[model samples]
Target: MKAPRAVIFVSLFLLTFQSKAQTKFDHSIWDQILLLNVTKDGKVNYGGFMKDSSQLYEYFTLLSQNPPTEQWSKEEKLAYWINAYNAYTIKLVIDSYPISSIKDIKDPWNKKFFKINGEWYSLNDLEHKILRKMNDPRIHFAINCASFSCPVVWNRAYTGANVESALENQTKKFINDPLRNTITEDVVSVSKIFSWYKKDFKIDGKNVVDFINKYATTKIINQSKKGYKTYDWSLNE
Candidate 1:
């Protein structure tokens, strides 16, 4: 039997409202925590964070309890998972403070610790199962692994409203930052991130170098030498 036209219209309106609400997630708590803990140069003060661990746990609890629903926009979901990955990473480090590297933990990325939407997730699940599947190479720049060679941890929380701009800024910042990528007229040296996720950057028939040149201030001429910087697993502290 066909539903009434009024009922159908009301249902559509409710669905639209729910989608908008999902996109309006509050990231202020995460933003405040990041501002206090992450430095301008992207180094984290694990010591300082340990002192205010309560706030960190609060953010984690908030995330686990309020996982994004299907009604949320793509950007909203992406921002949420990215924040979750970074936040959980910080928690893992603080849980084992005074540690030298994330690798020091036994399979840290695979450790199932995050509960979202009633399912427990590992860091790998967040990255591979969710973020990577989103098909945005810029995500590599946005999600920090808490290591020296990894992308700098941004000092602000990523919100659905700001995620697009935030990602573009991060991509530009990372590509131009000499510490992350060295681009010149001849050779182009990049972080191992490019090499590790080579497939992600291949968009519209562009290779890795092509992708880098897009954001790199200094354009590569010949693209002769491409070297991957040694990934420093030492804590970003």
Candidate 2:
């Protein structure tokens, strides 16, 4: 005795609704965590994060349960992975709190400290294997390495709807930030990020200067001298 057609239709409708709801991963927990522990200048309070570690744990569980799928939009994938990368970096720091730098943890980036969809992943896998493969260089700015010279973590969570603008803003802010780069028409001393991942910034056959000029307020001349500043690996806190 099969169920009535109306019953089958209603059951299907309910299932679809639940699926859609679950697919829209919430970032409110991560957002609140950032608001409470990160400064507007992007400095992190590891002590504060450690004190509020439960929320961070909850947020990590949410990320693990809602790993990106092919059904997700490009922006959705970008936002999810970027947030996971930053939040997990904070977790790494606080778990080993009192360290002067993330490098103090042996094989920090290689440690598989988190999971997404039941698969374990290390920071290097997330950054190099996943995010970099996404083909958007602005991610270099969005994902923080918990260091002084790395781009500061934005004090807000990114949503798929807002990620594009957020990436644009982060890139521009990092370039114009005098502490990160000194731009002049004749010469520029920029972050080692540019030197390390120069290939990522050279878009459409253009050179790295072309990419820098896209965001740098003081545009570098075509023939400007270029040099990389020493990266400060100290904790942002």
Best by TM-score: 2
- Residues 64-88, candidate 2, lDDT per residue (tens digit)? 9888877678888899999999999
Off by over 4 Å in 1: 1-19
lDDT of each: 0.88, 0.91
| Alpha-carbon lDDT of model 1 | 0.88
Where model 2 places Cα greater than 4 Å from the true spot, the runs are 1-5
lDDT of residue 185 for candidate 2: 69
Q: Taking the tens digit of each residue's C-alpha lDDT, what string does model 1 give over 10-115?
A: 9999998877766557888889988998988799988988888888888888898888887788988889988999999998888888899999888999999768
Candidate 2, residue 157: lDDT: 96
Candidate 2 local lDDT, residue 136? 98
